[model samples]
Target: MDDKKPLKRHEALKPLSRQHHFGLLFSWKLRKGFAGNISVNRLKAYADWFFVHEIEPHFKLEEDHIFPILGVRDALIVRALKEHRRIERLFHDQDNPKNSLSLLEEELEAHIRFEERVLFAEIQKVATQQELKKIEEIHFEIGSKEEYMDTFWEKN
Candidate 1:
């Protein structure tokens, strides 16, 4: 009776993999806000803040630096890029926070899962040592820990 969990990800993709962890946490936090009956305005404010501080740059890095390794024509790259556009629209949707957040929650999770299970595996397969090293170098400079003044997500 083997009960072993799956093997961890490869070393080269680990940083991006770590970013996915944060992305998933963002989804969970949104879920928590909904469950806790947090205000839509409060959640929207947080979402806007996160889009600026985190999601924007994260998406850029993946598109500009990471995804190009596999070329734009690659089906996975195409799908990822499309999802990025859709997710960006959802985040910035001013007319409908309720619907936008709901869709964002589900789509964001699906996008992360696709990247982790499919896209990243393809990327790792195709990326060279030099390419991976470049990714490592670029990502090492971007730290996630700078604090923001708004603690809306924190318990009051």
Candidate 2:
């Protein structure tokens, strides 16, 4: 039997975790688009949509609600915020979109992985019950449902 401890995600952060799942799906869809020789413009357009609909709000929630739990100076929070800026840049880079999309696919996946595996675990470990409750409140109020029109990731 493996003895490694399974990380327990708290109820407060569940919404963010679910968002991370969508982020991973976004990355996977981009990979599929790349593999299938889907047009870079199509992929970039979808990326832009996802950035506005999903990533921007998600980042705001984390920065405003969650990161303060760990403090801005905390190395993990600093790294996460930097990753957010980089990911945003990748999504917005229209001049060299093909390369940018490729980098976005990789970097976005890595950013999600970092949050899921490291930063969030630390946040949950240190956050007070009151803080967690507040996080849950804001998260629910934000309503994280995504409804993008194009299901470009679907196998044609």
Candidate 3:
């Protein structure tokens, strides 16, 4: 049974949370693709596109603007950075993309969940009003996602 009270995400974090929603959707699409028997090459192409466009920029945004609230030495930040590197490696593994994408699907979703539920909660607890405002200002481009033309996820 689940009894956790939902954290009311700070305004500064809402944009990232929106992006996390898409990240979860991305994972669901991967599962759909696998179930639909979509070709690994096709899935890898989409994963490559997403990693280049969304994941890279997203990671940079957190590392630059958000994670600093908790400092680089914080255990949560350390774990997040390690996850980021591991996810980057998973995204770039071309020789064994089938296994890699499968891992990526799981890894990315889990990473987003950890940030949303744990790290962000901790940050919000400690972040100053000015710090939150700074974060919001830096990452305030809501509803401006660049959509990929390939609809392999939909096909699957």
Q: Which prediction has the highest TM-score against the true structure?
A: 3
lDDT per residue (tens digit) for residues 66-121 in model 1 = 89999999999999999999999999999999889978988999999999988988
* Candidate 3 lDDT by residue in tens digits, 89-139: 999997899999999999999999999999999999999999998887784
Q: Which runs in model 1 stand beyond 4 Å of their true positions?
A: 1-7, 140-144, 148-156
TM-score of each: 0.88, 0.91, 0.92
TM-score order of candidates, top first: 3, 2, 1
Q: After superposition, how far is residue 126 of candidate 3 from its true place, in Å?
A: 0.4
Candidate 2 has its poorest 10 consecutive residues by lDDT at 139-148
